[model samples]
Target chain A: MEDLTAVAVHTDVSLWGLFWQAGFIVKLVMVGLLGASIWTWGIILDKSLGFGRAKRAFDRFEQVFWSGQSLEELYRNLGDKRTTGMGAIFIAAMREWKKSFEKGARSPIALQMRIDKAMDVALARESDYLAARLTSLATIGSAGPFIGLFGTVIGIMTSFMGIAGSKSTSLAVVAPGIAEALLATAIGLVAAIPAVIAYNKLSSDAGKLTARMEGFADEFSAILSRQIDEKLPRT
Target chain B: MRGSITSSAIIHAALLGWGLLSFSAPTPMDMANSESMPIDIVSDVSQLQKGDKKAEKNEKPAPKPTQKPQTIPDAQNVGDSETDVETKPATETKAKPVEAAEAPKPSETPVAKPDPQPEPKPEVKPEPKPTPVPATEVKPEPEPKQEVKPDPVAEAINDVKPVPAPAETPKAEPAPQAEKPAEEEFKLPEKVAMPQAKPTPPAQTAKTPDRKETPEKPKTQTASTPSKEKDGIADQVADLLNKQKASAGGAKRSTDQASLGASKTTGGSSLSQSEMDALRGIIEGNWNKPVGAEESPDMKIIVRFRLTQDGQIDGSPEVSGTGADAGLLNAVKSSALRAVMRSAPFNLPQDKYDTWSTVELTFYPGAT
Candidate 1:
């Protein structure tokens, strides 16, 4: 009669109950996959906020930059603040402009080249920040299923071994071990599906943000080059 | 990053809690969709099977006597052929199955009373027993016993009934009248013993259905049904008559030379499916398919053999039937027989030995 029921408690089928019921190795696998899932979601959240913040900052700065204000005043106003993302690129390029005039302009072409180079470096740093920690999402998405499968294989093997030891083919001997093993796989899938979806979503967002910043740099460099052209004749 | 981690942890914990709360009782599967086949575990076939095999047994033994009568054509002496023809067909027709066998069974029981009324002598009893070679065993026995008891002299000398033909049969014929009387003595005693040994019903059955002539029979029916019973009865009757004549006659020699049938009667309950499956698995395991001939699409091979109690092959398996290319057929047939031989000493239930003792297997060599 005791053997008839495989799992003693109905709670064992629940997520927490299953976690506690799992074998040590299977428990470890489940924990690892869960951690990966949580980490994946965390990265998703941070990236989401970061992309929004960059977009809003770009929107504000673009409004002001396009209003035909003096680039020197804008650069001086940004100098006092610790700026980043798209704003940092504009500041880095403007400082290069100010430096050329203060040092007495050598060549307009050289000034144009230095300002472009400064903006390019700032853009590289911004893109790097946006793309951070995404590779872990891809890793979790791909490896999670395999890890779950390993747990399942081990669980079933253990179940069969129990059956052999008990000398019976009763459902009680079979079902619980198999159920416990399959829970690993279930958790793995749960972890994997989100990681995969979030990785796709967040990476695409990052790509779009980087592309927008690259366009800004290109436009800002052109403006700086034009300002240098105007100053060159006066110098 | 720290805030995001806390938020992600809270979300995962909430999801996990929801999953835990959502666990419901497992519902029973809808049988219409599941469609699982149910099988019963059984130890014996008799428990599951329903039918009387007596009919089959009757047909099987029926052939034994009919073919024997042909050898002792001279044994009756008086219209010897007519008497032989009449008795053999009665049992043979009774062995005909269903309407013919059933109709004659009841008729033969009653008919036994009449055969005795005619001969009313010891000679009559002997002749009746032998003549009912098919259905006549009972008729012959009752008649002979009844006749010999009630009206031996009057029935032998004065009765002109069809059965009285036995006493008169010797007188009317020229060569074998003296021989038949002696033959009846030997055949009757042995035939009587065989029936008596089993049970009254089996005796009545063995003799009545076997005698061929209960009271009277058509010659044609006797000609068709032939088996070991015919050989044994034929030998018994033939040996009696042939010996009395000092063994010089040609037709007598053939009857004299006839051997006693080596047939055995055995019965038990059928084996359960598991036993059959085990037996099949053992055979299939040993069967390494003979190469090059497995592709013969139409090949069919049937092998029949008996097994001993210890699970050893009792005798070499006989290929009872085969249909395929002659060249490929032989390869598969031999391979099947080899498998049967190699898979000896099968571990089977000792109590159910009778059921598994005899087996017939059909092999269709193909992609399977």
Candidate 2:
């Protein structure tokens, strides 16, 4: 009777116990979820850092862009090496402008168009870089739960099998399996929740940053166009 | 960027430490929950005996017919021998020699042969001698002292036979103790007619009382002879028996009620334990722990709620706690609440309303 009571009493199923006791498929599911969760956290960390750095660098570059220095001198000071997000776009547009002047393309419209095209291309490339690996976050968020559920289902199935084999419907018999199974879903959610939230938050931040770059590109092209208008004879 | 990452790492490390700490902390609730009741074997045995005696007395009068065939003949033979000796003693000379020779054998047989074969002869003879001796020596003081001496001898013999016999004839022993001497006189015929109607022994020494009653009554009543003494001793013995029966019955009844009360309380309490476990199992079973919840083991939600008598959740469980990220905390809390809500109407005992009416359960996923 004491043994039975003990069996009945100490029915608390520990998490490690659950995982260790889980079947092959469930264990695989749990491992997969854990991997996904870890990867998601890594992505979150990397993206947040990258976005913060890009935003700060953009702020610094904007300060220098508007420092009222000669555009030629500023471009020269940037050197041949593309330094930052905004600098790279500025360099691409200026380099195309300088080339047009060297080639003696006296047509102001054509010069303005070339500079805009170069800056647009640069903006697209920078946007791509900012948006990189964001899809992984979305994927983890959406798929993590399902993977966890799959593990849970397997764990529960194992528990039912145990119940059938043991021929007793006692909680002690079934609690461990059920707890383990739930751990899978839990891990999945753990992996998925942050990934989902991070994806939403970071994607929007990235989008806003990309928009600012496009705005800068458009503004830079306008300045070049204004310069060409003043330098070329009236068409 | 480095500072933020370091902070995040520190936070994760702290969470990991907390989880480890919480995991290692032993839950005291498990010890509180598994309680055992101690059973008293001695009290139980005594109560059982009392119950047995009460039952025997209550059902005694009804089963007289079954015992009639076995005990009636012995009683009749006893009466006939008593009468022969009593009536012949009046014809002094002729009866004296025969009575003297016969008297010593009866007295000696009881003292010498403690066996069942000589029981009938000794029992019959002892009754007549004690009656006549007590009547002749009317000084009640000497008579009782003399009676007390032989009474123990008779009791010692009866004690051996009575153990098994009382089980079969509990009613006979006590009735014979009260009325055996008086019935040997004019009431002999009636005693024979209702020979099976012996009352149960009030005490352990039922046969000794019978032997004692025969001598005591004859000495007490030389005037009215059988009538007054018969009523006096018979009523006294009867009253004593009734009082004993009443007291035993009362004790047995009270103990019965106590046991019933004990069982009811234990039964209710035990039922609640299982009900609580069932509730715990269902909720825990449904809980899908959020990933990384183990990292923040301190993130616990205390869910308090009331349950109706019929086991239905009376109100929504209120979740209150703070730890981890909002998204993570909310996910864990909602999942915990959802599990409880999903497994609605817990299997609570209706009779034990006070125990489970309100519950405050702590949901710490990995710890549980």
Q: Say which candidate scores most in DockQ.
A: 1
Model 1 agreement with the true structure over B180-292: per-residue lDDT tens digits: 32335435435545333333333332232223333233222233233234555555654444222122233221212222221333233466667777777777778777786
Q: Give the TM-score of candidate 2.
A: 0.47
Model 1: lDDT of residue B30: 68
Per-residue lDDT over A1-235 for candidate 1, one digit per residue giving the tens place of the 0 to 100 score: 4432444354445445556666889888888888888888898898889888888988999899888888778888889999888889998988888888898987899888998899999999989988988898899999989999999998888889999999999996788788889988998998888888988998998899889899999988887778777878754
lDDT of candidate model 1 versus the reference: 0.65
Model 2 chain B TM at 0.27
For model 2, the chain A TM-score is: 0.91
RMSD (Cα, Å) for all candidates, in order, is: 20.7, 23.4
State each model's TM-score restricted to chain B.
0.31, 0.27
| Per-residue lDDT of candidate 2, residues B1-368 (tens digit) | 35544555566557645764576323545565332211100100111222232233331112112211231222212232343232233334343444444445545544543454354545546665644432322333343454466565566565454444446445454435434533244333233333333222222233344445555444444423544455565556445442221112222123221121221221223233455566677777777887877777557677777778777888687887676778888888888778778877777655555556676767765453
Task: State the weakest 10-residue window (summed lDDT) of model 1 chain A.
Answer: A3-12
Which tens-of-lDDT digit does each residue in A1-235 have in candidate 2?
7743543454445444455667999989988877677677777888898899999999988998898989998899897665767889999998998888887777887788888889988898999999888998899999999999999998899999999999999998997788889989988998899999999999999999999999999899889898888877786
State the TM-score for model 1: 0.46
Candidate 1 ranges beyond 4 A from true positions: A1-12, A233-235, B24-368
